[model samples]
Target: MQGGTTIVLPEHRGHRLGLALKVAHHQALLARFPDVEWIATATADVNAHMNAVNDRLGIRVVERCIELTRPVGRAS
Candidate 1:
C-alpha cells in the first residue's frame, strides 16, 4: 500500500493536515501489514514544506530523480 496523495484546501493548509494524513496512513499500513518493510513516497524538489513534514515522519531520501528540461532545438 502507498500514500495516494494529500491535498489540503487553501484554508486548511497551515494546520499540518498533510503531515497528519501521512503519519496516520503509515500507522494504519503498519497495523494491517506488519511484515511490510518499506513504504515508498515521493515529493517534487520545490515542495519544501511537504519535505519537511516527511522528514519529521522519519522518511529519508534513499534515492532521488532529477529532471532536466531544455528547448527542443537547444544543445550544449
Candidate 2:
C-alpha cells in the first residue's frame, strides 16, 4: 500500500503528531492486510522531519526520483 502525505498544521507543530499518525496507520494496515508485503511512501528530499519519522518506522530509502520540466513548446 502506498501512503499519502501526512501533514500537521503550523499550530500543531513540534508535538510529534505526524509520527503518531504514521504509527497508527501502519499498525492498522498490518492488522487489516496481513498478506501485504511492503508499503511505499515518499517525502520531499528536504522534509527532514518526515524523513526522521520514516526512519523511526524502519523505512529506508530504496531509490531517489528526480523530476525535470521544460516549456511545452520548447525544442531540445
Candidate 3:
C-alpha cells in the first residue's frame, strides 16, 4: 500500500512487478478483511509510469493533495 523510499531491484524492471505486488497485497487484504470498502494509494503527479500502472489496475483518482513546507524561522 506504500512505496516511500524502497528501491526496486534492476531485474524487476519492465515486468510490472510493482503493480503485480500491489494487486496481490490488496487482494490478500480484501480476503482477510471483507468489510473493507476502499483501497487507496498515491504517486507523484509527475510520475507517468506509476499513473499508467494505476490506470491499468482500474484505480480511480478521486482527489489530489499537495504538501506545503516552510523554513523554521518563517511564518505561515
Best by TM-score: 2
Instruction: Tell me which residue pairs clash in candidate 2.
Output: none
lDDT of 3 by residue, 23-76 (tens): 777788788888988777877899876788788888898999997887675553
Tens-digit lDDT track of model 1 for 1-76: 6467777787889788988988888889989999999878888978988898988989899989988887665553
Worst 10 residues of 2 by lDDT: 67-76
Task: In angstroms, give how far residue 66 of model 3 lies from its true place.
Answer: 1.3
Taking every candidate in turn, the Cα RMSD to the unseen true structure, in Å, is: 3.9, 2.9, 3.7
In candidate 2, stretches whose alpha carbon ends up further than 4 angstroms from where it belongs are 70-76
TM-score of each: 0.78, 0.81, 0.72
User: Which clashing pairs does model 1 show?
Assistant: none
- lDDT for each candidate structure: 0.84, 0.89, 0.74
Models ranked on lDDT: 2, 1, 3
